[model samples]
Target: MSRKRSRLSSEEEMSSKLSDGGCGEGQNGSETSITSATSQAPIDALQSLRQAAPYSTEPEAIAERERCHYGRIPRAAALAGTAHRKVRVYSDGIYDMFHQGHARQLQQAKTVFPNVYLIVGVCSDSLTHSRKGRTVMTEDERYEAVRHCRYVDEVVRDAPWEYDEEFLEKHKIDFVAHDDIPYTTEDCEDTYALIKAKDMFVATQRTEGVSTSDIVARIVRDYDIYVRRNLARGYSAKELNVGFLNEKKFRLQNKMDDLKEKGKKVMTNIGEKRVDILTKWEEKSRELIDAFLLLFGPDGRLSNIWNESKGRLMQALSQPPSPRGSPPPGENGDSHSPVHSRSSVSPPPPKSRRYETLYEAQAGNWMHRALNVLATRKRPHSGS
Candidate 1:
């Protein structure tokens, strides 16, 4: 409950500052602004909102430094010794993803009168989820978002759907700030009727263009990215509730031939491109699967190529070049070193420095290492 207070002289101006109807005034003509309390952003008449107030900070010195960077107005007011009654303006909502609209609404509410304290109540996730399908933000998240709004002085978690006389009296609520429209839910007949009858309803305009649904729709439109992201996170297609390609096979088997033969009748270039992409993807995956199977076979035969190639190269390299021929070992003490003859298998001509851009076939270091390991482990005595 907030203390009772008097309206400011800027009543007329305050009305225009909110929506066209002016921010809501209580049953007694006390005023304040509203907070949209849905999981998704609200969709309503659009208006050009004023710039949002900067985030609150502790320590005036620190605040000053940050404000200087953003060109924000210093937070200050001269209500210390004023004789005016302290006003308590009440407004609340789900406030799922708080933004400029929420800020604008709250500002209108608290600033509608002098010496104001704004109390905002955020609905519980259970309540919100029951009424709405799904909320992107949790109940706690919504509470924090609304609690920090520049307009809010206090926040109530799991706020009640309708106001009660006791709640009003305890807080000394002078005016309940909200739009004039009826706020009916399963829990209450008219959420604001009691306040309105007491003359506390204030009408604020709904900001347009941005809402939770709009944001959700944008993500859905880029569905492929969503699927890819889930995969990257180690979530399988089944885990993501995606249908298996086998299930969608009919879509292709039955229609691909028709599309290729008479595709122009219904399919455009865009459709053809998609078909080609799918075909290419399938072919590529098949190739990779076959390659891996052979490479990791029981005998690991793929490594044999590596060993054979390295053995030839090493044998060629081991032979020393000789300027003079040595005679074969002679009988008795007169012996001579045997002349080593050049083998038919000679090292291929020094490799030409082929352009890497041309991508000539070459066995990379890994392949060579694999072959060498296989050849070194072979047991001639245990040959089958």
Candidate 2:
């Protein structure tokens, strides 16, 4: 009986050991499973994030990126509401020269919808012509150019007709953006209404002086000479009659008058042999008057008086000396002589008519002649 009891106790001890070892193994397995699950939690979270994130290269994705970069909604995006937080701005144009004014407008639009994305709507060349007569650049060129702007987010070809609510709603637009100019109202009512209906914002910002029309006007003005020449060929008789060419003629006539006054003065200075002075005066006066009339007047009766006067002066200056020797005692030399003997002849009276006319005509001649001489004179002492 003592042997049987001892054997039963040994058997119980073995069973107890087996049970405890089994429990220990089970606990180790549970810990391994928990560690595996914890390691996989981050991987599962990353997979979910990847699914929720937007796809790059998609229009919507591109728009969002642009909005984030510029910190505002695009004009077209604002006009086309795709998201509740997104603002749509609609600016349609050829966008030929993307200058500071364009930048300012985009900047202003962003200011209105700080959280929205921007979508640029570029008008096709055909569509632009329907509204703006003509555009400097083509549609493709405008699109490519505007797309490169840092302020511009996305580009789409705008429709030919005016903006409609259906179009705005399809895109989920929130705002219609424009420059703060009063003239844009007539054409933008439909788009404006859509923005209001959507409870979206309407933003108008000030633009700098950079407009396609203004640029074209400046180009025309700067090349006025070429434009005028072409215009003259195509202009009708009535158009030509409005004194456009006559304005140039009038200016020429004034120049002739100035020359006439100058000649008159020169003649007055030649005193006693006054005929010689008068002859020279007539010739120079005629030349200036002829040049004036040639420029301003028709090819009619105005004579080449200046040419004739110049010929007469030359002939007088070239005449041979008098046949007889110097004049009789006490009498001054020949009237036409240029002798400078002060003791031989008494001075002419100050009140002489010839002297007076000479003084008047030559009053400003010396100064003018001096200026002309100085202008044409070679500079010997040039710093260079």
Candidate 3:
């Protein structure tokens, strides 16, 4: 990419064009015409040089070579482009979980100068681990992702987290391009501040809406599936700090049964003491709908209500149970649990070992029923 080499390439190209013209006209038997035609090559070359945009130290020569390259530009118009130095701009990052935002920043870096040489640097995995803890993709995978982007001209491996005088000098980087956000690390000064002093800072816009961290957060939000995925990838439960689903499913199923029992009791009282059977059914239906709304929040989706209701039930169940020797409950004092309460209020459950998977067939039924509840979504046609 040196100016001397560029000059040679252009000279070779011009000679080829002149040779083609000479051969086409030689059969016409006019040496004078041929000589006159040959003289115009230098004139054309000079015009191509002088009237054109500056490209390098030797702008005219480099422009001529570029003019003949691949899809040829008109000699005159090719010369008339805006002059731009062949810029070697540096942009570096962890580039973890490469996505559209990374691509946008690379595009920003390339757009800073016309005819730019964009070099993207990816941090080594160890360095990335030290700073960012963990990344979904390995360093090499991230490097390949960045390397294949249309805006990137080259990729430097094992790049440092912070740009320094040595790195800039070694790469012959003209400007350090990145977002304006200040990067503070124990290993270096604010990266932007350091580059600003040298006047080589070219701040590009940080892309909005999407980021690597945001993607990681979304993965975290789907807590159970994420832990399972890690387990599938050879990570252990201890590593993930999660437990088996069997016991939790059992406890959750126990809580659901307790709620259903309380709901039926509420319906029974409506029939026996408050009104006729049809009115009791109608009131019971309204109560169930209200409970469903509270469990599912504003969206009213039932998909995860089983787990959500389970968590809420845990708080209610955690209270210690009263001594059984005393009058069973609700006769003269607060009921021992919601299932036995006189008003059928859905209060806490008394402590019991019923959450254990003692019977194999019963445990299987509980798990199957819990899974079904977790999978179900609210139907548009349903009243509740």
Pick the lDDT winner. 3
Model 1 C-alpha lDDT per residue in residues 48-155, reported as the tens digit of each score: 112222222324323423333221111222123242334556787777677777777788887766556567777888878887667889886787677656566666
Quote each prediction's TM-score. Answer: 0.40, 0.36, 0.42
Best by TM-score: 3
How does each model score on lDDT? 0.57, 0.56, 0.66
User: Alpha-carbon error at 171 in model 1, in Å?
Assistant: 2.6
Worst 10 residues of 2 by lDDT: 326-335
lDDT tens readout by residue for model 3, 235-322:
7667776677743554465567679999999988876876576776897998888888876766566747766999999976586544
User: Could you tell me the lDDT of residue 349 within candidate 1?
Assistant: 32
For candidate 3, the per-residue lDDT at 205 reads: 90
Native-referenced Cα lDDT, model 1:
0.57
1 or 2, greater by lDDT: 1
Model 1: residue 93 alpha-carbon error in angstroms? 0.4
Give model 1's TM-score versus the native structure.
0.40
What is the overall TM-score of model 2 with all chains considered together? 0.36
Each prediction's number of clashing residue pairs: 19, 29, 1
